[model samples]
Target: MIVPNREKQAKLRAFLAKEAHALGFAQLRVCRARDAQDREELLRHFINKGYHASMDWMEETLERRAHPSNLWADVQSIIMLGFNYGPDEDPRQLLARKDKANISVYARHRDYHDLIKGRLKQLSAKLLSRLRETHPEGAIKVFVDTAPVMEKPLAELAGLGWQGKHTNLVSREFGSWLFLGAIFTNLDLLPDEADKDRCGSCVACQEACPTGAFPQPYQIDANRCISYLTIENKGPIPHQLRSAMGNRIYGCDDCLAVCPWNKFAQQASEARLKARDDLKAPALADFLAMDDATFRQHFSGSPIKRIGRNRFLRNVLIAAGNSGLDSLSCDVMPHLDDSDPLVRGAAIWALGQISPDQDFAHLANQKQDQETDPDVKAEWHLALKGKTS
Candidate 1:
């Protein structure tokens, strides 16, 4: 005779490991939520410093974000899983061309959330099917970057990887290229061995940050982060960091792209998330021509659509400013009268860069009558004075 709890745990672990592999997970690990006080303290400190910027959602679900049991109540074991989205091409190559905008590797393909969530849901269904017979009363909930769970720390806890100094979960085998997902379950599965911290004396990610977004190791200032400023932020991008944004029109993966550990990441097994040729390094002139409908059509399944036409154009304007190509002066001119304030402001800033004195003056004169957005007006005033911000 064997202990029932041990047998149950063993059975559940074996079943989960098989199901995860078949469902396309790169790896799966389980752990009890024993300790998270330090992470909780860090979260509070992150809030105190306003490091999250305008992302009030992080503040809104503070309690549930810090604690696992608070989320599902009956979660006895936390299943932290890795979804590998290995880069199909050299990610850093896009940065070489001055006239081409560098879209992040992750956004070069179809959105990972949609693809990974669909797979996670399928895995959940399989788990429930197994539970109906063995652990009929067991409950499970899945989360993928949504919800309040401290996913990076939880992944670290469940032996998926150690949380790198960049605050992203990094595994020795998978590197930093893995997308994390979680399955909160009532079944008490045997916990996996925790991953050890391997980022010793390494500061590659820190030095890679263009805007100095990392104030110290293991922390990121959301306000200066190109990813947060481009994707998450809804208002005007700060003047200082705009120029540092370079040609990265979507998200910045400089820190991740520079990681030495990514050398070991396997190319994505999911073909749908593979990089599209057209998206790799698109011409800025052609990139500027996309209106909302065209933008939606081009980036339908891609993550670039999250920023919409105006914000995307705002990023393009900064890229245009950095381009040093007089040819794009005409391209940036029409945006002086853009419907969105952020776009108009970015246009003003870009025009002051490449525009010959005559064309810029004419643009300022032409848009003077129609412009009412205060921010745009301020930018227009600044541009006429031959100032570039």
Candidate 2:
């Protein structure tokens, strides 16, 4: 019969913490992946209210989400790590530019998923090296937001930080601007004491959301979230929320930007997390003209690359429609013949905004000959009738 090596496991934990700090992680903590009844209620409330919007995967695999053991029976410990990616400049500064594009700070850099995953895997490999030398039976697994794991709750249990009223983890040190990731193992390492909730009575994060995504304290309905509508939802945005969306083309940073705790936040050290000057308040007209190849090239080191050209242009057109930038109408005209119905629909809306024919008859007449996609055709007809397209 084999028994775990206690001395080596202790050394492994300390070494991991040291290596993790050197890797640019602001802080790290550990916890036993226990039952997360509190998180289950929050997720259930979000799902019931239809806040998750089209992110249906959040509803699937419910059992594993509520109970970490359901994901891996042998898992006994979870390592919660936080990486600071705070921008040197304030994000709210973008809000003042209601006429310009507002790309979230996180997307200003290379895709964080790629960056975090490679780093986490390296850390996991470090542990595996120690396991091979001593506890040969040890095993490791890594996860980020992509998994069904209840990372926030486990992170709370690990003393990384307490969950704030807005549902984002907040630390006294790095505040709410940190990205979270986790690793679970079969080792029974000592768990850190959970952080005391420091939110007090502040409701700034909730009040700051432009779309009213948070229904109550500590809960978000993803359906009403600008981030979800812009990044996750595939179809045309609902009319009621479009004007309120302003120029946010990718994701909204209002809630995260308003948190007072972030005053203590430090600028990110990862050169990959730095803000790209071109993406900072990028011209809506420039983003509107991006073809697939151009989109890939422009966002090569940026997270916006994942959304593809059509989805991105659709967002830009919506902002252009609300922009009241009538001069932009000429720039939007060519997209009426775009291959994607989504683009054509958005183009029609932008045309209706700037084309002063009372109705979009001028643009509709031009599109009638070549346009396909019944959705876009009907939209063109409505635009011609002086109706909201």
Candidate 3:
């Protein structure tokens, strides 16, 4: 059995810190690959309550996610790394600008999965070389957000940061805007002291949620979350929650933006992860004009491209509906006959919210007979009912 070597481990830890900083990782720490019992129980409870919503993958990977050992049996050490991607401006300010889309700060740039994964691979290769010098058979594996790794809990265990009330890892140095990655290895390494939860009596994050997605301080119900509704849900967004979504066309960042700890956050260091000028606060009208080809070309390397044009347009129409801008009626009315049912449904809602009652009624009458999708037909019926009532 491999035993811990204090002197050798100290050297390895120092080497990792130096290497990680050179690779643009803001923080790095190590922990044992043991079972996280409390986290496992919490995850099981959350899944049992169906808080995961349409994300069935969370329930499916419960065992592998429950403990690092379950994922790779030979794993003895887990290294948690943090990459700060803090925005230069407060995202909450954009909420008041109803004409502009409020995209989450992280999604404003190149996908971190692409940026951080490559960096993780580079760091892993260097670590493997160092390990081979001593333990020639040492094995290593790196993971970004793709794997079923409980990155937050492992991060806290590694002393990288504690999971805040919003359930995202928060660092003293980087605050709420950090991207996490992990590396698991067979070599026995000394674990750092775990970070203690510092949040006390602050309900700012919970209060900032527009849809009240949090059932408690640390738990989130994915069903009502704007991020889940806009980015994850493939079907029409639930009608009841549409108005509360406001102008956020993509993921929402209210909770993250409200954290007082963010006062310490530094702007992102990597140029590739910086926010694009055009994406900062795009006009809702501009997004509604994007066809599939235009959307594919515009969001070519963006994380938003993954949601596809239809889903994206669905979100844009929702924002337009909530904008209360009657002048945008002409722009929205054209989408009433959109090929995609989700876009048509959202267009119906937007037209109802922004168009004159007579105009909406006339269009509804003209299109109602040809609307094939049950959901789109239901949206028209609901809009008409809402108008008359």
Candidate 4:
């Protein structure tokens, strides 16, 4: 009877793998729901060090995020899926093109949340339907990044990949380009062997960071990370980090792109995952000129749209500042009086980056008395004093 049960479990796992691949998932694996419980300490350590930055949700959902079992009492197993979104060319290549804004490779197309979640639900329904043939109580739930679930650790547990020194999952086959999604089910599934850490002593990812975000190997300081500063941060980019930011207007891909494991990476197969032509390397001037409506229409159906026009413009202005093109100063000038102080402050900083000192001081004197926001006013003073840091 036990042999028959084991055979049945194996068959169910095989069926899951088939359905997952059919749904366009690059890889699939299963693990006990509680397999990631040990990651709680790592999460806590990350939060304790203030590494999560302004993402306070991590603290709010600490317990539930630490263990999958905490998320659902009846969950017996977790199905982890990896969908490859590798780029055809190295994303780091854009870093040298200061005139073009470097958006992260992942954000160069449609948002992964919508693409992955719909497929997760479809797979869950199929799996649950199959399980119900034997156990009527079988049930399932699907999650992308919406929940507090520790996806990277769970993916590691499911043998999908090991979390690299950059603290992002690194797949030997897909490199650092796989997007993760998960399914939780009440039915028992045979867990696969967990993937061993293959990082060894490779610190290429650590050395690639422009902002020195890594305090040490395998840990990240979100406050110093360009991705966090550009995307999650709502205010001005730090003065010291702005020069290092270059023309990266959205998210940073340096660490992920520098992985030695990328030799095995393949171009993304999904049409929606491929980079859109215009977004791949948009000119800083083009982005600096966008207003709210234009920004929305341009980024429609994209993850970049979620950042809103003000924040998006703020990033563009930072890129413009780093472009070292006096031509962009004209494009950056109109934003100096933008309705949002965030944009105005960024414009002030951008001018400091490109405008002549005499011109910057004159403009600072002209705009000084009109500014009410202390932060914007402070920017004028800082720019006038040549405090680029």
Candidate that scores best on TM-score? 3
How do the residues 1-389 of candidate 1 rate in per-residue lDDT, one tens digit apiece? 11148777687678878988888899999888654433567788999999999999988888777788777777778888898888876677777787999887788888888888888888878877877766677677888887888888888878899988888888888888898888887766678888788999999999989999999999999999998988899887787787788888888888887778888878888787778889877899998888889999998988888778888888888899877788898898788767788988998888787878777778787776668887888877877886423
Q: List clashing residue pairs in candidate 3.
A: none
Q: What is the model-wide C-alpha lDDT for candidate 3? A: 0.90
After superposition on all CA atoms, what RMSD does each candidate show versus the true structure? Answer: 2.4, 2.7, 1.3, 1.8
RMSD of 1: 2.4
Displacement of the residue 209 alpha carbon in candidate 3, Å: 0.3
Candidate 2 per-residue lDDT over residues 271-301, each given as its tens digit: 9888888888788888777789999899886
Ten residues in a row with the worst lDDT in model 3?
33-42
Per-residue lDDT for 1-389 in model 3, tens only?
Answer: 24357887788789989999999999999888864443578789999999999999999999888888888889998889999998999988988988889899989989899989999889988888887766778778999988989899999989988999999998998889999999998877788999999888999999999999999998999999999999999999898999999999899999998899998999998998889999999998898888889999999889999999999999999999999999778788778878888899999999899888887788788888888889889999999988888
- lDDT of predicted model 4: 0.88
Off by over 4 Å in 4: 1-4, 387-389
lDDT of 2 at 305: 73
Q: Order of all candidates by lDDT, from best down to worst?
A: 3, 4, 1, 2
Q: Identify the candidate with maximal lDDT.
A: 3
TM-score-based ranking: 3, 4, 1, 2
Candidate 4: residue 15 Cα off by (Å): 1.9
TM-score of each: 0.94, 0.92, 0.97, 0.97
Greater-lDDT candidate between 1 and 3: 3
Whole-model lDDT per candidate: 0.83, 0.81, 0.90, 0.88
Select the stronger candidate by lDDT from 1 and 2: 1
- Against the hidden true structure, what lDDT does model 1 obtain? 0.83
